[model samples]
Target: MKYLVTGTAGFIGFHVALYLLNRGESVVGVDNINDYYDVNLKYQRLAECGIDRGNVSDNKKAVSSKYPEYSFYKMDLADKAVLMDIFEKEKIDVVINLAAQAGVRYSLTNPDAYITANIQSFLNILEACRAYPVKHLVYASSSSVYGANTKMPFSTSDNIDHPVSLYAATKKSNELMAHTYSHLFNIPTTGLRFFTVYGPWGRPDMALFLFIQAIEKGQPIQVFNHGKMKRDFTYIDDIVEGIIRVADRPAKPNPEWTGQDPDPGSSYAPFKVYNIGNSQPVELMDYIGALEKAMGKEAIKNMLPLQPGDVPSTYADVTDLKRDTGYQPQTSVEDGVAKFVAWYKKSYGK
Candidate 1:
C-alpha cells in the first residue's frame, strides 16, 4: 500500500518511513523540519533516509537517493491546500500522522505552538483523510493524556478528561476530533497513545537524551520528583512495529460498544485507541543507573521536586493492542539504553 507518513524528519516518523522503505513499500514523507530542536539532527535523519538536506524545500517533492519506492516533501500539516494536493497526487492508501509540537514542559511556556501544531495540523490531516478516503489513519497520541489520574496501568478505556498540560489537552483533542470524522465520514481512525518512547535518534528534549548530554559534560542531571518517578519507556522500534501493525488493520465498529455506558477508547463508528507501551514500568533511579552502566560513567544527579504539568508516573495497559495485533514490546530498558548510548557516542564522536 502507498503510505503518507508525516513528520518524516522527527524521531518516530523517520524510523517509520525508513522501515516502510526497507520492506518495499511506497512511502511519501512530509515534515516542516522546524528548528524546534537541532535542525541538524533532523537533517541527519532525513539524510539517513536518503533525502538530501540540500534538496529539501517547502512543498516540493525530493525522491530518496537510496530507496526508489520512497519520496519526501518538506511541508507543514497546517497547510490544507498543499496537503490535499499531495493526497490527490500520491493516492495514499494509509496515512500515519506523527507530526506535532512534542513537549509537555514546552507547552507550558508556549501554548500557541501546541494549538497550531497539534490541533490545527491534526484537523487538516482529518480533512485530507476524509477527502481522500484512505484505508487506515493511524496517528500519534500520548500517555500524557492520562494526566491527573492516579490509576495504575493507564488504560485506553479510562476517562482522560483531566489533562494537566496543554500538550496533553491537544493530544486528547486529536482523539476526539478523529472520533468525529470516524463517525461522520466512516474514516477508519486508530489513535496510538505512545508511552515514553526512547532510543537512537530520539528527540533532544526527551529525558534520556537530556540525561546523556548532561552526564557527558559532567553537569548534574535533574531528577524530578526526587528521582522517585516511574515511566513505561517503550523503545522506538517497538513503537514503529506497533504503528505498522495497527495501520495494517483498519478500525472497525466495536460490536460491544454501546451509548448507554460509553467506552472512551472505542465507538460504534470505525474508531479505536490503544496504548502502545512496554507493560513494565521502570523506576527513574533504575533508568539512570542503566544509562550510567551503558555509558561506563556515573552521573551527577540533582534531585528536584516534580515540575508543573509533570506527572509522577505513567504505566500503560496495552491489552487491546496485544489482543488485536499480537503486539509486544521486546526491548528491556537496560538493553535499549545501551544501544542508545552506543549510537550517541558514535554519532557525537565522544
Candidate 2:
C-alpha cells in the first residue's frame, strides 16, 4: 500500500519512511521543513533517503534518486488548497500524520504556533482524509496528555481530560477530533501516544540532544525537576517498528464497547488509541548518567525546579498495543543513549 508519511524530514518520519521504502512499499513524504529545530538536520534526513536538496522546491514532489519508491514534498499541512491537491493527485492509501509544532516549554510562549500547526493542521489532515478516503489514518499523540494524573503506568483506559500544557491540550484535542471524524465519517483513525522518543537523528530541542550538546561543549546542562523526573524513553527504531505494525492493521469497531462503560482506547466507531512507549520509566538523573557513560564525559549539572506545563514523570501502559499488535519496545536507556551519542559525534564531527 502507498503511504503518505508527513513530517518525512523529521526524526521519526524519516525513519518510518525509510523503513517502508526499504520494505519495497511506495512512500510519499511531506514536510514544511520549518526552523522549529535545525533546518540543516532536517535537510540531512531527507538527503539520507536520497532526496537531493537542490531538486526540492516548495509544494513540488521530488523522488529519491536511490530509492525510486520514495517521494517527498516540502509542504505545510495547514495549507488546505495545496494539501488537497496532493491528496487528489497522489492516490494515497494510508496517511501517517507526524507533523506538528513539538516542544512543551516552547508552547508556553508561542501559543499561536500550536494552534496553527497542531490544531489547524491536524484538522486539515482529517478533512483531506475524509475527502480523499484512505484505508487508515495513524497520527501522533503524546504521553503529555496524561497530565495531572499521578498514576504509575499511564494507560489508555484512563481519562485524558486534563492537560497541563497547550501542547498537550492540542494533542488531546487531536484525539477528540479524530474520534469525531471516525464516528461521523467511519474513518479508521488510530492515535499513537508517543513517550520520550530518543535515538540517532533525534530532535535537537529534546532533552537528550540538549544534554549531549552541553556535555560535549563542557557547559553545564540544566537538570529539570532537580533530576527527580522519570520518563519512558523509547528508541526511534523501536517506535518506527511499532508504527508500521499498527498502521498495517486498521482500527475496527469494538463490539464489547458500550456507553454504560466506554473504553478510552477503542470504541464502537473505527477508532483506537495506543501508547507507543518503552513501558520502562527511568529517572532523569539515571538518563543523564547513561549519557555521561556513553560520551565518556560527566556533565556539569545545574539542578532546577520543574517548569510549568511539565509533568514530573511519565510511564506508558502499552498493554493494548502489545495485545493487539505484539508490540514490544526493547531498547534500554543506556544502549539508546550510546547509539544517540555515537550518531551525534558522527553528525557533528566531534
lDDT tens per residue, model 1, 49-168: 889988989899999899988899999899999999999999999999999999999998999999999999999999999888999999999999999999998999898999999999
Pairs with steric clashes in candidate 2: none
TM of each candidate vs. truth: 0.99, 0.99
The C-alpha lDDT values of all candidates are 0.95, 0.95
The residue-by-residue lDDT of candidate 2 on 203-289, one tens digit each, is 999999899889888999999999999999999989999999999999999999999999999899999999999999999999999
Q: Which ranges of candidate 2 are over 4 A from the true structure?
A: none
Model 1 lDDT, full chain set = 0.95
Residue 113's lDDT in candidate 1: 95
TM-score of 1: 0.99
RMSD per prediction, one decimal? 0.6, 0.7
Scored by Cα lDDT, where does model 2 land? 0.95
